[model samples]
Target: MSINAKSADHSPIDEDAEQLARLGYTYEKQFKREMSFWGNVSLGFTYLSPVVGVYTLFASSLGLGGPPMIWSFLIVGVGQFFVALVFGEIVSNYPVAGGIYPWARRLWGRKWGWMTGWVYLIALLTTIAGVAYGAGTFLDALVGAEASTASTIVCAIVMILLATGINLGGTKLLNKVAMLGLIAELSGALVVGIWLLVVARQHDLSVLFNSFGAGGGSNYFIAFAAAALIGIYQYYGFEACGDVAEEVPNPGIRIPKAMRMTIYIGGFAATFVCLSLILAVPDYAAVISGQDTDPVGTVLSGAFGAVGYRVVLGIVLISFVSCVMSLQAAASRLSYSMARDRMLPASKLLAHFQEKRHVPPYSLLLACVVPILVILGSIVSPDALVVIVSFAALGIYLGFQLVVLAALRARLKGWKPSGAFQLGKWGVPVNIAALTWGVLGITNMVWPRTPDSPWFVNYLVLLSAVAVVGVGLIYLFAKKPYTHSDAPAADAVPPSGSNRSVAENAQSHHVENYL
Candidate 1:
């Protein structure tokens, strides 16, 4: 049971060890071990909840109608396929702690890489706020707690604190907690979806195709585009799997496989949810006019009654909590890795680890703190949170777009993966398509409406632009550069001395506080 004992059980470096030896620290790796393949898949699915998928389906139905919204998923899928392919290449080649940011840095340059990382971090943090905000609304609706800002903000802070605590134990605990949450959520969604589809008669497919304003919009494409954004939202967190390269066993193969499986499973689950909602329009108007509080539960209550509705609401809360875990894990690790490389401030503190838990404790604390502050700040201005959500979504698109472009740029530069999960010859084309689609999405986010415009989406554009530029400036001046030597080889470092960089002994630095 001794920390240094290299026996099969005590060794920190193992197929399942959550805190791997390769992680630099005098602290022995003592957290829970890595997940089994099935465990990983389940965790990923939970983080990417299908309940949200149905929510998106209804949103799209309102704007673009059911048929067009489905088409939007297909369209976004194709675009994301390219990005995924490109990610496949980079991850396969250099699966490490820092993912897209490092990939961008390696393929592009230090300046650009930092820019990518900074924007991605901002986006992620912003999205975390959105999730917390949404979860607060759901919590209020399901339990009928005091619906005041005080209650919502406290609830959000508690959720973030819980996620941080789970992650402070390292990846294994995070995965296990996340898996359990996802299972509860997904099971509830599956039940609702199947029940709805079975009980209701199929609607006219052609009617959905032709209904221009099914949700009350005039233009079909605009409505579909808006709704499509919702469907795509459910698939957003899969990229987090790659961010944990330092912990994933045989990351070269495993990370890519996990990424692919995450998308496939998440996509399939989402599609099922979308289909069920489309078929089970027990009350389409009610679903579309969904409130910030317990919208999905409201729809379920109408269809399945109070008992059934409560169960679904419970599942939705589980899903939200699971998502919070996933985001916290990804965001904190990103901070740890970035700070470890001197890319963020106070590297020493953010990168510190607890020997018993074998985790970046400071990073977790800081991450939890900032988001709570953000939530509290939201109490003063509700609309500000909406702007934050849009900004965060835009940040993901911007960062990923560069990563996709980098993948293409790398391929064009003649770089290739030396392992499994190749996108074959289709890699380059797929990446290009992903870039184009991602860009289009970012554009929509930026200019959702115009001042003189008919629809009220112009402010979205202005807000997104301000967010991008504002965040970009911080990266340009504040963050440090990542060197070529900073790019650690995939699986190059072994257990005991694994964390040693090409430059020197792995420096004792603190991780960032990004929750």
Candidate 2:
């Protein structure tokens, strides 16, 4: 009954198809498996994009937690690696599209999967919008245009459309662009970090210990917690590797490896870049005391000069576009996976794949259109946009924890992961650790520490999470989308020694209920 079972006579492709059949699904050969392991890593790395993360949040983190805030990357990186391990095991066993959705569906039930996917889908779309919007800010700077909310929104929409067009070209182009993005982003980070450290270093390593009066001398932990967003936001895009599970050959083996590589490589790059920027700042006191509002730009322009700064700015823009492209691809795949299960409105259309291109056209369109709408909505109330964008990281963490919880539930019900990669005796401990880290992370993100800000603004992360789940609950009960699909429900493996396949066991349970 284990999906990992392989026969000497069966080829890997044949075995994969057999596994899919055993899970009550047919293997669609038209869905090309063109991505190699490195390509998968590139997708995730570009999505993680240290350039985007460090550039966007450098000033905020420095202001809030001082130079010491650079350590947040290490802290968050370790926690996310635990998460990556959990995901690797799940995806290796299921090897299903829609990273979290399908894995949750198989581990727990349809309802759990539906809600997980729903929350994750909204979060992913919001993230896409946020990334594109960030890209727009950089693009405006690159073109020497004035920066404004209106201009940013307009530029964001254009970027979204560009990413959508590339995505529509199919997985091959996605892989190639992702690899190019990986090269540009990594090289840019290295060049920038080394240049700053060697030529523009203004602070010694000891400066990392100084708090610079952050947290008002009462609670440095609170300030650190607030600053943790820099790491939390950057670490997650690794899951995008699993989002394209169906497009990678030998995915059971390769995707897990790629996921780990993303965390290891991406974490080091982010940390190095953050450290370099922190050391290169002209004055930490100015940044912390609210004098230097644009510390990131100050350092880059000062270190690289005017023309060199523009070149670096252009590289940052590429990182943003690549990040947007990867986000869009992941979001579209999640949509297609959910729609194929008839779990969403317009399932038939949303699940429609362009046979020639081997891409889900409608799903890709949904991903593009929703983010554009989100960008446009910003024009009405920019504050509302901030609230929604804040939920992106918290919502993604919630979605990840739900899958971890589901996996724990399955293990308690006697399901041992028989994947190409597994933690074995370490599974339960690692799972517990990952879940604990995730809970702490969610709390850190949602905690209202800003006494000066408005009540809603302070509590935006928590409020937005509640609002998303509230709406999803209402829709779930009213529409009963789970009833439309014939996929297995609460399909946790029974006690050991069962000869029946999982699908067979699910069917037998259904028969027994009927009697």
Model 2, span 1-515: residue lDDT tens: 24444578766666556656666668353467777788899999988989899899989999999988988998999999999998988887777778999989989989999999999999999999898888777777777888898889888988888899989998999999899999999999999999999999998999899987976787898888888789988898888999998888777778888999999889999999999999999887788888998898899889998889899999998888889999899999999999989999999998888988999999999989998988898889887788888889888999999999998888777776766677888788888989999999898888888689889878888999999999999989999999899975566566467644364442221100000
Q: Which ten residues in a row have the lowest lDDT in candidate 1?
A: 506-515
| Residue-level lDDT for 303 in candidate 2 | 95
Candidate 2 clash pair list: none
Clashes of 1: 21
Q: Native-vs-model 1 lDDT? A: 0.63
TM-score, candidate number 2: 0.94
